[model samples]
Target: MTNSFINQWKFFYPNKLPISHCFRQYFSQFWFRIHSLPESKRYADTPAEYELLLNRHNQIIDDCFDSNASIFIVTGHYFSQSDNNKIYDPTLRLKYEFHPEKEINLTQANPENYDDDEEDHFYRPYSINEIWKKNEHNDLLKKIADDEVRAFMISFEQNIIIAPYDGGIDFIIFNDAKRNELINKYKDWLSPRADGL
Candidate 1:
């Protein structure tokens, strides 16, 4: 992260977090990416995901707001590659922007032992996108009888945007008939593309 962006974060988490926290996030992401290169004939590429990326995200959020969906938004970024094992913008669509604050509800987020598991290092109850996923008014969709989440509302500053971000992505196991129907109907838009979150 740049100094300007670091300075900007102070406005968001004033006393709880420090300026260095911002640096560690972007820096480590960039650093690890540098070390995790595929040495061979690799190059840059455009985002394989089309507008469907945004569409799928919205769909899951709609489901979560409905309170019946168990899906969690899992976001992954793809980067281009180089022969020298260096991952720079010149060769990849690296995760330049990670919205850790996007998701439904993350109040239960906690990690007991990260040392034993690398996945735990980035562990959270929700996807990395959820900025703040706790708003009661989102229950409107849950009570409404609809096969799909056409549209919805939330209560907060810029509730329309934040509500979705707070909850990462919709993750339902499809244990019953109703949710199974939803998955089958919106498979094209709901199925995750080939990317890691």
Candidate 2:
């Protein structure tokens, strides 16, 4: 992690936790969830489903960013306190192997942890600066859709965070107007439940 990126992130999100799943709760007014597949299916069961899922991801991402936009791709690595080699999820091991970039120990840098009762694990963040290209991240997105890996993309220039998980994508847009415009544009992808999931 470069000092420039760290400083930029802190400027946009001071004292905010980097964990992707917690974004909705922490920034509820500026957050929205869009299901990757129809009927809120968690994973792609067939080739067609995978295609649809990728299309949704790519389209939404394109709308959130400009063509060939600069993006910060962030992934988390949670290792046990007793053993740095022991990761909470085995699939994440594969992700780090592919990237192999130095990770920042968020557990030590950030003041807050995700949970209070669970065993303490070091939460490290691995980030890379890349240019957003349509369909260029299909492989990574596929892993996310299969629940094999977890990651999120941040566009500091756009002032938005696009976090894609196994089932859906959680967007943290600071601008109320932009967020509402997305919610309206992707209304069909929004969860049907009253809670908006």
TM-score versus the correct structure, for each prediction: 0.24, 0.84
**Model 2 lDDT on a 0 to 1 scale:** 0.80
Q: Which sections of candidate 2 miss by over 4 Å? A: 1-3, 86-120
lDDT tens digits by residue: candidate 2, 74-120: 77677765667644454354433434343545555553754453445
Q: Which digits, one per residue and each the tens of the lDDT, describe model 1 over residues 18-125?
A: 211222243332211010112211221223332233334445545434443222222222121222232322112212233332221112232342334433222111
Q: lDDT scores for all predictions?
A: 0.27, 0.80
Backbone clash total for model 1 is 35
Please report how far candidate 1 places residue 51 from its true position, in Å. 3.1
Best by lDDT: 2
What TM-score does candidate 2 reach?
0.84
